[model samples]
Target: MALQVILFMTHRGRTQQLVLRLLQARRLFPEDRTGSRTRHQRIAERLGLGYQVSVMVPALLWVLTPALVDAMSAPAANGTAATRGTPLPVWAPFDLQRSPNYELVYAVQAVTNVVMNLTGLFLDVFFVTLMLHLTAELDVLNLNVASLRPSPVAPADSLESRDGDSLAKQASTDAPYTARGDSFRVRTSTSRFHMYRLLVKNIQHHQMIIM
Candidate 1:
């Protein structure tokens, strides 16, 4: 646990950089028309919730086990009761045998345990969500690449016939390829340029994911 905390603190910059790269890739890539982005998002949420439930349920049970056992146990036959112990054993300066002190301390310990569990849950969920997002980005990149059409000849009056205007438009749009029939159809050389540019972006995104 100490090592985990130390690693997290020491590698905070790396985590931030990874998140930034993922976000940048997502923002710069084209999304699928089949509503995959939404589907992947929902899957990520469900997985995160599943992780929270799976981890916290057991943790809560473990934290409360001592209290539950104490409540369930029978008293001694000699008119004496079993001494109740704290959920977590910790040395204290003041006596914990008294009324408010024991209850307060027990409550504090239980709450602290839950909070620490939640902290671990947050870290787990963070990595899980990032991985889900990266997968979604890869899906989009694959879709774009698969949808690339053959380089067809452009008409004389098409956008490719124009000088810099077509290049400017291609540079501005993130998707670049518009949907047509089975694949992304190109009317001009400008659209071909867009396809190649998008493919390069996809390659770079894959490299980042690998790194």
Candidate 2:
């Protein structure tokens, strides 16, 4: 069990390090691209691999845990022979004569099986949730990137004369007034949809002014 714990911790630590490295690489070179793929794609592939390992390790352990417990409790060859010698620390726990509580041993194994199953279940749920969350975040990031890209038609050219006139009039009356300066600031606290609409309206007004 101690060895298993050590191996699990080692795997977890390495997985975390790999994921962090991938994230850092993505951040450092977001626009970097291969022949047919972008940095995001590369990072995603690495993340997916890490996720698979995270899921598979626990599942493998879950499958083998019962067998391992049974093997540990199984009687050795030349059964029912008592050994009267110095007690070695490693073999003391397995000495059935010295510890003849078969019921307790069985109870411990049952509890271990229950704990292993619960741990597996928890890990499955956690990984599923994490994958869903990462997918949603990636989708949102893609949408925001698409929205920010420049369209083929310039904003000034897209507006009709009548729309421009109306926008100018609206801007003169309704837009926040500010003096000419090197920089300006605008502040608002609003819901996302409302903020998006407000931004579109402001962009149209600015296009009208520029034209």
Candidate 3:
């Protein structure tokens, strides 16, 4: 959903943070397609897999936007064409047909975001699990035969969550507490719930996520 905010601010373009990192990464990993394998996964490490998600999540959300818009704009009725050109089964669940306007556009965006973020998170976790499973079939190969390739994997001790001391405290086992106004975390299996929560927050509070 942070990414959705970025794209909403950036308008479907390469995110500024991503563009900078991509350039930096390309410069470091100039030996593209060396026709061999490398244990270091230089490119992946240069721009962490989490950051690479910047490109993918937005692209997918873009693909879904039109379909969602189409669905929302369809007829108000919900049926399987037994009636006169009733709405599609998928679109009927949305509350769009009440009084379509600019408000509908915002609702469309929010709904799309909920779907996009949730789907992306699920796919991310799935891919990570698949990667861990691939360790069993792993093979060793060098990326460069004649050129020197530096190791990209950093010290394990340096890895840490930047969610911060406050967030850590919030997630800590001390007590279920609220921080900075009414913000309190909720457990979600899918990122959609997170997105849904944010949408509800912005709508109910009449504020925008400028950050």
Candidate 4:
């Protein structure tokens, strides 16, 4: 369960980083003067609008897992009278209330919970810092892209002009190819994120049952 959680968190971080890169690329390139959208711009906009919703799953799991574990391991409703009067099941490994090692088990559990909580807190802080940094970088990239412009020389039928026209035409036609590549990248990233999340959820369910 712990390993699965770690994997989930790692994938989530990767996805966030990919989104940041997409945003940076979009800001650096901006849209064409012809009013056409770039591949980076479309992907960045889609991810920026929807990525926050995906984060809620991990955030909720981080907050709720320890509480769920504690609740599952809580003493039975029949209470101390039952614990004192009845013998543990023959198949039981050890009785939580009667075992001499009970304190040690509880200490370990408490420490584990503390470690998990601290890890979650660190992840939250890291994500916030990353977002802020990305925002600043994005603003700077936007300024740079906006300041860039074509040379002021008038068009002509010279070799230099023909070469320039060909380059422009090539760049315009490459947008579809760029869009296709971006679509593949975005799909792969999102699929991996969702896959890890689902695995983590399954692991959580299993851990709850075991507890």
Candidate 5:
């Protein structure tokens, strides 16, 4: 019973998270995609268990009402039916003890329990849907956040890569000079201490011949 009480709470953390995430995403993605405006026929499909079973929680409660009442109204092993107008020590958690009305109280409590269970099921599924949508919204949030984040090491990274390539070329003793787009090129010679001369610039004014 204690476990049931804890698990039966209708207010869920996931529902709150979903609502919060949806609100956060709404600022950036203002448009919502609701169903189409035109009337449409429902598609008939076979549903196995776990397929939208949440939708039937309340309906199933009504269907099981008679059986639930019968189960609760059964006498205990002692087999003592109550006297008229006096409550009976029914096996129920609550006082069903009424002389003639014992069965009525017993039935009512059974229905109440079933109804509560149905309510809990509804709350659980709604939370699950909310959490699922929250996850998608969180992805959207991450993208929006990333869009505003600045590139950290772009310039330095390019310089480091170039340096690494130059060192590799030197290590192999193969400085097969090739002209690249508008950037500086190295003219190689084994005689020079540095073993290369830099030819800078495509524009005349910026031209420099480095030894």
Candidate 6:
């Protein structure tokens, strides 16, 4: 526990920076490419639920087992005081082995144990959420790349006559296109400009993830 605390303290600044970068990247790629509450959100929710169940089930068993055993093995009314164990072993200022005291201490320990487990689970969830969002962004980038198509060939003789047709086709096919729409056109000075822009954007995204 001490080591975990120390590690958290040491890496707190770095974690903050990572979170900041993630936020900035979100702004850069804000479009929900897969529509509302995409696959990543669903995955995160399932993972979080699984984590909660995984943490809580063991904790419940740990807390209840000792109490169940003690109840079944309780000393007879005529017998002397029986030894009892707390859910967790810990020293208390007062005698926690006595009635009400033991129950109260046990309840406190159970609550504390659950809270501690949940705290750790929350940390796990935070990192997992970040990873999921990163993956979602990468997936979006892939879709963008996949949507790109090589410019269709225009016959040299027909190129002059089909100039308007080519432009109209480009507009229809690449609706919502950005300024960097130049494709592999032999006559265009901005040939492959869209691909270059895409490459640069991906590189910047990669750098953001790295940082």
Give the C-alpha miss distance for residue 17 in model 4, angstroms. 6.6
Name the lDDT of candidate 5. Answer: 0.41
**Tens-digit per-residue lDDT, 117-205, candidate 2:** 55555555545544543443344334434445332322322222322232233222323323344253221212332455545644543
The digit string of per-residue lDDT tens for model 1 on 1-211 reads 5566678889999989988887777676647676667778899899999999998999899778878888999998997877778878887898777778888998999998888888888888887887788788778767877888756544434453222234334444434434333355434455566677777877887887777
Q: How far is candidate 2 from the true structure (C-alpha RMSD, Å)?
A: 13.4
TM-score of predicted structure 2: 0.31
Local accuracy of candidate 6 as per-residue lDDT tens digits, 1-211: 4476578779999988988887787778555456522778789999999998998899889988878888899686988767778778989898877879988988999898888887788888878987887787777766666666555544333432123434433432423233345553433312354566667777787788776
lDDT score, candidate 1, position 10: 97
Give per-model CA RMSD.
8.6, 13.4, 24.7, 18.4, 18.1, 7.4
138 Cα displacement, candidate 5 (Å): 4.4
lDDT of 1: 0.74
Q: Taking the tens digit of each residue's C-alpha lDDT, what string does model 4 give over 1-211?
A: 4674687577996656556664554454443343233333454555544554455456556545644664567577877433322111223366655555544454455566556655655555445544554454445344444544433332222212212332233322222222323443112122343555555544543332223
Q: What stretches of model 1 exceed 4 Å from their correct place?
A: 90-95, 157-194, 207-211
Relative to the true structure, candidate 3 reaches a TM of 0.21
lDDT, candidate 5, at 193: 19
* Runs of candidate 4 exceeding 4 Å displacement: 1-103, 145-159, 162-211
Give the TM-scores of the predictions, in the order they appear.
0.73, 0.31, 0.21, 0.30, 0.33, 0.67
RMSD to native, candidate 3: 24.7
Q: Pick the candidate with the highest TM-score.
A: 1
User: Can you tell me which runs of candidate 3 are displaced by over 4 Å?
Assistant: 1-122, 129-211
* Candidate 2 residue pairs that clash: none
Off by over 4 Å in 2: 1-100, 143-178, 185-211
Tens digits of per-residue lDDT, candidate 5, 120-207, equal 5555555555444544444443433333422232222122123344333343343544444426544333333132211111111111
Q: How would the candidate models be sorted by lDDT, starting from the highest? A: 1, 6, 4, 2, 5, 3
* Selected candidate, larger TM-score, 3 vs 5: 5
Number of backbone-clashing residue pairs for each candidate, in the order shown: 0, 0, 0, 0, 8, 0
Strongest candidate by lDDT: 1
Displacement of the residue 200 alpha carbon in candidate 3, Å: 58
